[model samples]
Target: MKLHHLEALVSVADAGSIRAAARLLQLSQAAVTKALRELESEQQLALLVRTAGGVSFTDVGYRLLQHARLVVGQIERASEELAKLRGDQAGKLAIAVTPLVMVTFLPETVSLFRKQMPAIQLEIFEGLTAVALPRLREGALDFGILALAAALTDQEFDIEPLFAYESRAMARRGHPSAGKHSLHDLLDQNWAVNFTPASYESLMQDLFWQHGAKIAPARLHSTHSYSLMLELVRYSDMLTVAPEPLLLTESMRNWAQPLRLDEQFGTRRVSVISLRNTMRSQAAMCFVDCLRKVIRTRSRSASEANRMLFDRLELLF
Candidate 1:
C-alpha cells in the first residue's frame, strides 16, 4: 500500500526471516512485523507463510512478491534519478555484463564514467544473458551488456548493439584438442559450457552439424561461473566455448588458447539490453555513452564499425 509496505515485503523475501529482514531494513523487528501486518490487512490477503526454518511465500505471496520487487526497485531508481537531476551527481546504477566485457574494456569505461560523476554508485554483475534477463525484468538492473547472435528482435527490450566478437573453443595450451584444425578432433574430448541465454548444447550441435562433424564429448559439464568454466578447462582436459578475446588476457593466455579449427565460430554482438519503452536515468545514459566511447577507442568490433548506433543513442540522451 505504501513504499515501506512494499519495501518491508521485498526485504523479508530477500533476507529470509523477520529479524534478518528488520536488520536489512534498518528497522526494529516489531516495526517490520507491524508493517507486514498493515500491508496484509490492506491487501486482504496473507502474503507470507511461516516456516520453522524461516518463511516461504505462498503461491499468491510469491506472485505478489515479484511486483513488490519491481516497485521497490523503481522507488530506489527514482530517488537516484531525482538526485542526479538536481546536480547532486549522486545516483546508483546496476548492470549485468558478460565475462568478456567484465574483464576487457569495462575498466576503462568505468574510469571514464567515474571521472564525470564520481559520486554515482555502481553495481556490476558478471553474468550472461541468461542471468541478466530476469534481473533486468525485475528492475534490478539499469541495463545489461549481453552477448547475442544477430540483432535483437525481442519486443521486451531496447537493444543497442555495441560491438561484435567471436566465440571460440578453448582448452589448456597442450590439451589434445588444441592445435587441431578440424571439428572432429574435438569429438572425443571433455567439454564445459558457460551458462548462456540459449542452450549451449544445441548451439554446439548446430555448429558441429554445419561442418559435417558429429561431436559426442567424453563428458559435458555445464557451469554457472564463467571463471569456473575456464578453470575447468585449464586444469583438466575439458574444452570450453567462450569469447575468443577471453584468451587474450595475460592470465588466460598463459594457460589456454583457442582451438585452431578451420571453421571459425560466428561473431556475436555484445549489446546493451534494457526493458522496452523505459527511459533510462541521466546517470545510466552517461554510463552507456562511456561504453560507446570505449568501444570506438578500442576498435573491438569484428564487423565494420557503425557509428550510427552510437551517434543516435548519444543524441537521444
Candidate 2:
C-alpha cells in the first residue's frame, strides 16, 4: 500500500530472501518481514510463498513486482522534482558528448550550468558515436550530442538539429604545409588521426580520398582527446581533422590551423537527442537550453573564424 512496503517486496524478490533483502536495504530482517506482511494485508493477496529454499513471488506477486518498480521509479523522480521546486537544482544529468565537443564546448557549458544551477549534479561521458548511441537507448544516458546520420537510429529518442558546421583538416599554424595551396601538396606530411567506426570517421576518410590523399598509416593515431591531438600538431608537422568550431577556438587555433582541402568538402549537422516519452523536469529542460545556446555561440564564432581564415588563403575547397 505504501511506497516503503512496495520497496520491501521488490527488494526481497530481487535479493531472493528476507535476510538478503534486509542486508541489501540496510533494514532489519523483522522490519522487512513486517513490511511485506503489511503490504499483503493491504492488498488482500498472498504476494509471496515461502519454501525451504527461499521466498518466491506468487503470480500476483510477480505482477505487483512489475508495478512496484514503476511506482518506485516515479516516486524517486517526483522527489527530485519536488526538491528542485523547493529552490534546489538537485538531480542527475548524465550526458553523452562526442570527444570534440567535450573538449571544445563542454567547459563553457558546464561553467555556465554551474553558475546557474550549482546544486544539480553533472556527469559527462565522452566516446565516439558507436559507444554513445546504444547507451542512450539503454537509459544509461539522459541525453546525447552526436553527429546526425541515418545510422544513429533510435525511435525512442527525439533528435533536434543542434547546429551545423564543417569538418576540416588542420596543422600547426606556422608549419611548412600551412601555406600549401592543395591537399596533394601535404600528402607526405604526417597526420594525427582519431579514427573510429562512426560517421565522423567515414566523413574524414572520404574527404581525404576525394583530395587524392590517403591517411598516412605511419602517422600518429590518436586517442579521442582533441587537446592532446592539438598539442601534437603544435609541436610537430602533423595534421589532424576536426570540426570547424573546434579548430576556430582561439586556444585551439594557436595549436592547429585549418588545412584548405578541395572545394567539394561539405558541412555536417550535429544533433541533440533525448528520450521522447519521459516527462522532463524544469532543471533538465534548462540544461538542454544551455547546450543549445553553447552550440549557437560556438557555431557563429566558427563562421566568423572561417571568413577570416579564407581572407588569408584561397580556401579552395
Candidate 3:
C-alpha cells in the first residue's frame, strides 16, 4: 500500500473522525474514506469501524498503523541520513513536551541546538503524557519528554532516563506553614492541588495515600499551569504540590513557600522517549544526544554535591 494510505489511517485514528482527519490533512471527507478503503483492500483486513463517536481502529487496524509508523519513520530517517552525508545538518524535528519542562527547558535546548546546527528545522507541540505517547508511537513526533515510567505496554518506545526530581507542597511566602516542617501542620490548611482524578491528579493523591496520608479534594484543582496556582496561593492560604524545578523559578520564589514533608511524596522520573523500531533519524539522534549530555552534566554535579553534603553531615553527627 502507498504511504499516503497509511498516513490517512493513522490520522483518522488520531483525530477520531473522518471529518476531523480530513480537516487536518486538508482533504475531502470522501477522499479520506477512499484512502481507508484502498488501505484495507491492499492489507486484506479492515482498519477502521465507524460509530457515533467517529472512526475507531479495529484490532488489525491498530497493528497496521504501528507498522505504517515504522515504515514512514524509516523513510524520513533515510532522507535525514542522506542530508547529513552531504554535510548538511538539515531536517525537520517534531517534539512533544509538557508545560512544566517545556517552559524553559525545551526552548533553551532548541535555541542551543539551532545555534550549532542552523540548517535544522524544529517544531514543538505541547501535550500531556496521555496524549503525547500515542502520537509518538504513530510517528507524529520524533521525540517526547514525559514524567512517567518507561514500561509502556502498548507502544514500543526507548526511554532514556534524564533526571529525577522531587515535587513539594508550595504556598505563599508569608503563609502559616512557611516556617513549618511538619506534614500535619500543612494538611490542616485548605489545599490547592494540581491534577484531575484518574490521571496525574489521582496519581498525586495516591502517592500521599500510599504514604499513609490523605488529602481532601482541593479547594482548587489545577492541570500543569503553576502561574494560576501561584496566584491562588498568594491570595489565600491554599497549598499545592509542585515540582521543584518548576517552583524554584525566581518569579515564584518571592511569593511561594515550599513546605517540606517528613516523607518525600511525588518523586518523578523524566525521560527522552522515542519509538524503538523506527530507523534512528540523524536529527532525532542528535537531539537525543543533546538531551543526554545536558542530563549527564547536571546529574553529575548534583551527585557530587550530594556526596559532599553527606560527608559534612557525617562529620557533624
Instruction: Give the number of the best model, judged by lDDT.
Output: 1
Alpha-carbon runs more than 4 Å astray in model 1: 38-46, 179-188, 196-218, 262-265, 300-317
lDDT of 2 by residue, 199-304 (tens): 4456555556666666555654654655566667788668776676675456675666677755445555567777677656565677777776775565446576
Shift in Å, residue 197, candidate 1: 10
The C-alpha TM-scores of every prediction are: 0.82, 0.58, 0.68
Candidate 2 ranges with C-alpha deviation above 4 Å: 1-89, 98-108, 126-131, 148-156, 184-187, 197-205, 209-220, 275-281, 293-317
Tens digits of per-residue lDDT for model 3, 69-181: 76776677788889799987768888877655665356556766776668888877765665676678778788887766323343577776665566677778777678877
lDDT of 1 at 163: 65
Model 3: colliding residue pairs: none
Mark the 10 consecutive residues where model 3 has the least summed lDDT. 308-317
Candidate ranking under lDDT, highest first, comes to 1, 2, 3
Off by over 4 Å in 3: 13-29, 39-74, 83-90, 97-107, 126-131, 148-156, 176-206, 216-238, 291-317
In TM-score terms, candidate 2 sits at: 0.58
Q: Give the better candidate number (2 or 3) by lDDT.
A: 2
Q: Residue 220: error of model 3 in Å?
A: 7.3
